[model samples]
Target: MPQCREVPSRRRVPSTKITVPGPPADLVSRPRLLTVLDGASEAAMVFVGAPAGFGKTVLLAEWARSRDHEAVAWLSADAEDNDDRLFWSAVLEALGGCGRIPDGNPLRLLAVPDAPSTDLAFLGQVADALDELPEPVVLVLDGAQEITSPHPWQGLRALVRHQPAGLCLAVSSR
Candidate 1:
């Protein structure tokens, strides 16, 4: 019988790509700025306050592509999601797009009508989920300022102010 050599154990590695596309030539500078912000030790919330043609979304999409061990979620704010409940539901769904939503009841509350009052709870759940992740996540909210409703923005601000170590938020407005 031939003896088999013992193989070394290897650690399970997380995926490095998050499917974020790069920006066009016209929006190059913004990506660089985002890179700088991302590298900081402190948590950051980037508010891209500009008009529609300012290329905020393009820059963020590109910057997200270059990150290592990062997940990206894009939410296109629409009039239908004016309510905090609806907005968060959309946000969570977007996070799902990047494989960020873990399996649990934390998202179950989204089905409830009065979920907005529990915005902090949702934020906590999101933060906890993201904290368990080995990679960082970037959530891009395009047309964020259009939300108009105080509740959604309040929840968003709260999330930004107390973001998990592995999560970051980038909001763009016109």
Candidate 2:
């Protein structure tokens, strides 16, 4: 059995980055929007685009929190994630914490400091692992507009292209 690898410490990833934000105290339940999101659960990818102050974060956070069976790996991207390594590393960390990835999974390899961030083959391996998950996992990338690097985008593209039924990608951006 593969041992669980520790998340790389080369970059000091802020806890807030991987932590799912709670719905705002003043949040109003939007059943209609939540219902729409629930209806789209089968989609491989869901994009929520809106301008600032449009409650994009609140909606995504609420949706993530309400999931009873599906695990949600939330990442609030920031400008520092422009570096491909940092971006992918944070993603791996988030997924690792989602409690859905089985032990000794290939996805953990990307958390190593020396792992290739933009390697399509390696990303395909990660996708394969996600494909075998017994339960669904939704990876929500809030504030995704901060990720401007093409390399990370390429890596993301690979993951999405090979996305399996067990994995769902949710992204919110301005």
lDDT (CA) per prediction: 0.61, 0.81
User: lDDT, candidate 1, residue 165?
Assistant: 70
What tens-digit string does per-residue lDDT give for candidate 2 at 1-174? 999976555455788998878777798999999999998878999999999999998999899889863398889998888787788778878888788887787665454344445665667767887888888789999998988877777878878887776788999999
Residue-level lDDT of model 1, residues 88-117, one tens digit each, is: 666666666665445552432233235543
Clashing residue pairs in candidate 1 (N, C-alpha, C atoms within 3 angstroms): 22-62, 23-62
What's the count of clashing pairs in each model shown?
2, 0
Total residue pair clashes for candidate 1: 2
Q: List the residue pairs that clash in candidate 2.
A: none
Q: Candidate 2 — which residues are off by over 4 angstroms? A: 1-10, 112-117
Per-model TM-score on C-alpha atoms: 0.68, 0.87
Cα deviation in Å at residue 56, candidate 1? Answer: 1.1
